[model samples]
Target chain A: MSIRDLARHLDISIGTVSRALNGKSDVNPETRERVLAAAKKLGYVPNQSGRSLRQGTTNTIGFMIESTIETADNGGSFFMPVFEGVQSVFRRHHLDLVALLCGTDEDPSAYLNRVVGRRFVDGLIISATTRNDPRITFLLDRKIPFVALGRSATGGAYPWIDLDFEGVAATAVTRLVNFGHNRIAIGVPASDINLGYVFQDGYKHALAANGIPFDPALVLPAHSNEEGGYQVASAMLAQKHMPTAVILVNENMAIGLYRRFYEAGIHPGRDIAVIGFRESTQSRFLSPTLTCFRISLRDLGIKLAEALLSTMPAFRNNYPQERVELIWPMELVPGESDVLKRTA
Target chain B: MSIRDLARHLDISIGTVSRALNGKSDVNPETRERVLAAAKKLGYVPNQSGRSLRQGTTNTIGFMIESTIETADNGGSFFMPVFEGVQSVFRRHHLDLVALLCGTDEDPSAYLNRVVGRRFVDGLIISATTRNDPRITFLLDRKIPFVALGRSATGGAYPWIDLDFEGVAATAVTRLVNFGHNRIAIGVPASDINLGYVFQDGYKHALAANGIPFDPALVLPAHSNEEGGYQVASAMLAQKHMPTAVILVNENMAIGLYRRFYEAGIHPGRDIAVIGFRESTQSRFLSPTLTCFRISLRDLGIKLAEALLSTMPAFRNNYPQERVELIWPMELVPGESDVLKRTA
Candidate 1:
């Protein structure tokens, strides 16, 4: 029902009816009550465009993610739990969470600009950060309240929560080294995503610490999915010397890696040791269970929400903090996939 | 920049500036061109709230999905491709697609009311429809343009595109019966989701066709995830007489079923035949590859977009149809999981 209709029914001015509906103090209590009663009885829903224009807030938060072939393969599994966690916190504050998916055809920066320009949300949580993400710079310049799910080298004092890819790689290398494996290979994303650089750097640093020279040939770059995992295994086989053990940055890749190895009669735990990035449903069900890192995705999401809220002026008091930069830690889950012992 | 700022800079009244910016016919052509150039140069992003309030359209579409624990287990993999397809179509019309996640704490009908009340989108695509959904009635009452990804028992002249769950059940049952298995079990969702009822109906009809009596004991209900699949296997082992063949309604359940069977020393392809509902990444890598149904999610998404657009007045001409009620088809991908033959 329109404001005019509500006003006509109440025998009052449309301004009075609108003021009463919006909880303005100018309207008398008895008249305000009558307007509200009639409006509720008549099922009047306030126009959000009108309300937002006046209040400058939509009571909504956006979580931006990319929709790509690689994302379609396994990104959903990674983000679903996080979305749930973010929503769980938002629900308490009567805020809604909407996911803004950046299509493959659109550049991430352009998508961010469109969304921000529209004032579609009060805050944002952007994931899959690149080495020098333009979206970060755009958001920073706009003074928009946002949190990055991963780190970027964009030179900003913005909050971000990144997974400890460096630590994961280093731990994997140390574990494999303790088993007396001299030749070790690592699988990382071929893209310019910031995590890949951190992961490879950790691998190189660990190699140096173990007194083993870094071999460029031992580093394999591909998409971070099952297909990429299969390609990594194929590339290893074609190499001049195959590594005794390998580390994968994505758990989904383990499926393809196993499939390729299975076809060649090279079982992961028996023929060659393997360490996967994170524990997942598929990883748990793999024949020789995948030895991977585990993290509470839901908790990570909760922290992400708090971090974002801490930056926004409206909710900053509730989540008071100096800064929210953090490297989320993961625990190692031992399994048969990395049980192979190598002779020195 | 605000309209006032633009007007001041251009030495024009706010009303003239607004008219020129909105391309109103009353504005002189020269003034309109001058305002447009200055607006562009000054990086003036037209306030969407103001624009939408005047136009009565948001140029946005909402895809409503649930964020339940069961959804977290596997829903992301199912929706990402569909989002891509829907965005692909929306991108052509310059319409933005945002995913509205209904949290577990709030009732879906209530959530829909708030979103619709806010006039958030021009159209909507709602998924995971339940039997006799209240959201359908609410939307119908509000005269909102929407399409359902799954069908509902809710009596309404609304468009929906649902999977052929009944056909999948019948096909699986027929194939298992042809393998000389008199007793067959089916795993279905324990919830009141419409698909569960449809799937069971197909199973019953198929049994009758084979001259077999309906056995309530053979139908097992659980969540449509890996944990549910494991429970189904556990329930089967506890039965007085285990069915020789079993069909699952979700491919994700295969992981749990396989794990359970492994612990119980009952091989799926050898000891008992199994037919999974849909083919997925997990299904492909399954030791004894899962015999499951396959459907192109991207195509399904494209159809869903077309169906929703057909119902919307602005885009109806482009996707003209009397109605969009359709049962999306699936093809069986033969695998070793259900290859067991029983000698009667």
Candidate 2:
């Protein structure tokens, strides 16, 4: 059955029948019901694009992720858990998730345009933010509903979920200091991402609070992986002024440092002290388990989903800058890696 | 607008309008044009459910995954990569992905029913297979197209992609033997998964191939995580007849073994040699650097997607005995963790 038959049978204009079926308020309620019932009976359905253009919703969320193999590998531990958490909430709400892997060389904006301009999803979840990120500005200018996974360094007006890096770093330092480690080194990612800066600030703050002068030479920044840790430790071991303890920002790198120290004929717990972030299942079983902070990526995902859902407008309008920052508390798991006797 | 409105505007019979929109052979050319013109002007669209029912296809793939924090963590590493790889292929083919996370407490069959009976997906990719898995039977009996990520022990016929655990294990053993380490212990997962068995077979085969008798006492099966590794290694250390070297199957467990060995006052490369499978970026920069095999999860994902697209008919058939198996080759990276001098 076609709309023409329903219109002829109802003795109304075809345009009137069309307007009623499309849920336009201009159509009379009684005529709209009759048209809907007739269309339902005839099994006539509208197309997604047409429905989206009319109703302004796709009931889908687009996630634009950097598809680089290297970043993806780190994200396995860093970003994926958060995604799983977000998915859990979406599943409960019966919402669909559309994932787009943006290549490092390709402008992510192009992909976002394809999804947003084409009316594919109602909201977005973005990760791996940089200072003055073009993607953030594009999403903001377009009035697209989105929540960032991390805070932007340039200070954007966006809702985000982040860890208290500075707080955690300071805690780690103080714990090591209380254990009588005067010469402490801070290891962080070499690149300038927001977390690196936060960690550095925390390290400095903790040193000042403890009356220990910050040594610029003791602050080592390397790539955020085991190789980075191994290289940093190798360089430190070669230096004349070696630290009694080390605070690494990355978890995988700390694992590398543990191995590096072992290779250099040094016992992690007995000789030198170490602390890092991210508590992997492997951290607990290391001969002298690693003392580190644990954060739930899944919780981060749930928060991002809630933020996205709450921020979406019924129609395009300027959204309020309600920067909802969900900061998860870091818990330290003490292990054999930091067994230095208290000197203070 | 409804289809009936388009038909009425064109002054054509509802049946003729329906036939033309659905691409039926009997519609006259002039009448088809009239119907097409009216549909274009009015924006009439057919319903998706009716079309799918008529065509016997939804053009979507279902991926059922176990929903545990540990499993989810592994999913980021093992599943997401493959999912992305498959997505790359599916995007070209104009297919969609429907992901389902199944809980351990909930019946897998019920979840399968909601997705399959509701006609949400055309095929499935089931991960973390076990012996006599009910999911395998449900998909097979329903004639649903699916490929298992891991091999099933029940001898159920199905296409699958798996890591060559036996081959890699044997390779690890021989490598250790070549380095003059005769007494080697093999670490397996304490879980009842089929991969653990495959690893055991490989470890024994390699030892036998090198003219060394297999020692059941040397076979250590623990949980497939870091703590499991620590407990198993601690046990091995306490043993009167300790192996000069150890080969671990899982990467998480290997990290634990590294720590346990150190705590036992043993140097990884000098006092005891170690080898592990599944090399991550973190493993490369370990103190002694870890010697192990690496499997690409991304490659596995791409293959699964190709399989899903090809086996649609067999999947829809009552009997799903046809099977495809793809084995990924593992490469060995030399590191100080293995005592190379022992074999010489």
Candidate 3:
């Protein structure tokens, strides 16, 4: 069956039927549903490959996320809101968004090459960017329209919208210092992901600004999850001079830290001061509620979509000169986790 | 750049090069990396569409998931492990898995139709099955190779592998009854998802089996997320008689329930017994650790992949007579939350 037959069967105008099938906003909801039902019933399989080749577009955008153990443990909470925001923007333009999940064992660059070569999506939004990401270089070499969700030190000058990890670290350190914390420790990600580097740099600079001597021993590296937090607390307990305060790069880690502390009869707000990376439903409800940063993930997703669309030749006009290289800001939410005052 | 040229340039046999490109296990990891790197550097764009059409297969699998707020809140933690398991199986067969995320506002059936029509994937794995799912009917009508991650009341025999919600409800109720609790309650999904119906039915049957009258007021329907759990707690508090024990279908809700109970100066294990549906990283770390069920999601994913493959013509022989209609089991892990005995 074809579009013509489908429209005739539904007793709707061809334009209305086409518009409904294309997911155009102008069509009435009832009319769209009716058209879709008729099209499906009549087996109207659109010549997707032929049409895509002819029109030079598939009208689909792919958001690539890696489903690593670390990501599965926490990234879902981060990506879902962002996806909703991105979808909100794409819907108006009759675009469909699909998540291209990279398996833990697969090489991301090779996966990108295969997907890009297939020409399945008009553009891509790649997350979990590492230092000098090869995917960025590959995308640039192929002249593919794309946006990186995290900043990379790669050679290409492409659009990226990263969470202000440096700012978060700096702000957190400043707060701890003002609270009379001279001996402070930070839990950094052990992975080569660029955020860890940025966070460490920010922490170092903030310590320097406070006129405090940098102690390499205070910087603990661990997996960016609850286990990591537990490890950080363990390391602090083992320290010759325990830090008066500790800052964690991953909020999920707070749970583990709290558990470890509780086992040793230590209370977060009463015995030690703690600060987490971001606020989440889980973090908000933690006993002695976690002090963390908050960002509108949905708004960030909208910006990400706009930034990607601006790079694509077809939709560049809609977002004129809107080439974004943003460091999305996070606001601190004070809670009971960091209320301790240091005793001299 | 063709495979022939690539083989010659790398001084590798053409068969080895082909095997490496196809992701065969026989090829050395270093050789595969060399082949992939050379292929990318030489700009060898595989004729994916042409090859797919000629072979009548795409060597790709699509797992359809909805990114609705309800799903976004808790589904991420659940799906990530499942995805890892699914990928583990698919990688062996050189099949790539992509998640087709249906937007919150979009109709699931319509999205399925579009993706199926595009011939993007050779097979599919659909999740979040409703009481009367249209996607199942559509897939069945098209004679597409697919598997449902949950069961539906829709007609036509199809493969499905769903969590044993009924068994869980019954088992929890029996345990609570044995603990001398007559006024037990259950929090179920407000949506018309099939699991809710199964859970409620199991609950009612269990209540009858325990010689206790089934009160409709005792059955609470919520959004299947943390906020929903809070609402359930509030509703129970407002009741004329509060339940001594309660069961939640979604483990994520336990967090909200714990928050609400803590605010009301109620201790879970001492005041009211609680049993959550599944064990998770967050739940395991909850204060007064949650009593819940455990299922290896990775193992479930592997089974799901095998079940779907059994339905496909090409892979049918590999898993003969494995047309799965499984009610996957969950083992109970007793914890501190449900140790209280009801007052005489």
TM of chain B vs. native, candidate 3: 0.88
Tell me how each candidate scores on DockQ against the true complex: 0.66, 0.15, 0.46
State each model's CA lDDT, in order.
Answer: 0.88, 0.72, 0.87
When sorted by TM-score, best at the front, the candidate numbers are 1, 3, 2
Clash counts per candidate, in order, are 0, 21, 0
Question: Largest DockQ belongs to which candidate?
Answer: 1
What lDDT is reached at residue A254 by model 1?
Answer: 86
Residue A32 shift from truth in candidate 1, angstroms: 4.5
Residue B222 displacement in candidate 3 (angstroms): 2.1
Please give the C-alpha DockQ score of model 3: 0.46
* Residue B155 local lDDT, model 3: 82
Relative to the unseen true structure, what is the C-alpha lDDT of residue A107 in candidate 1, on a scale of 0 to 100? 94
lDDT of 1 by residue, A222-317 (tens): 888877888899988888878989999999888788878888778888889999998886667666789999999999999999999888888888
* lDDT per residue (tens digit) for residues B224-326 in model 3: 7778888889988889989989999998888788878888988788799999999888666677789999999999999999999888888787785657999
* The candidate that achieves the highest TM-score relative to the unseen native structure: 1
Q: How many pairs of residues collide in model 3?
A: 0
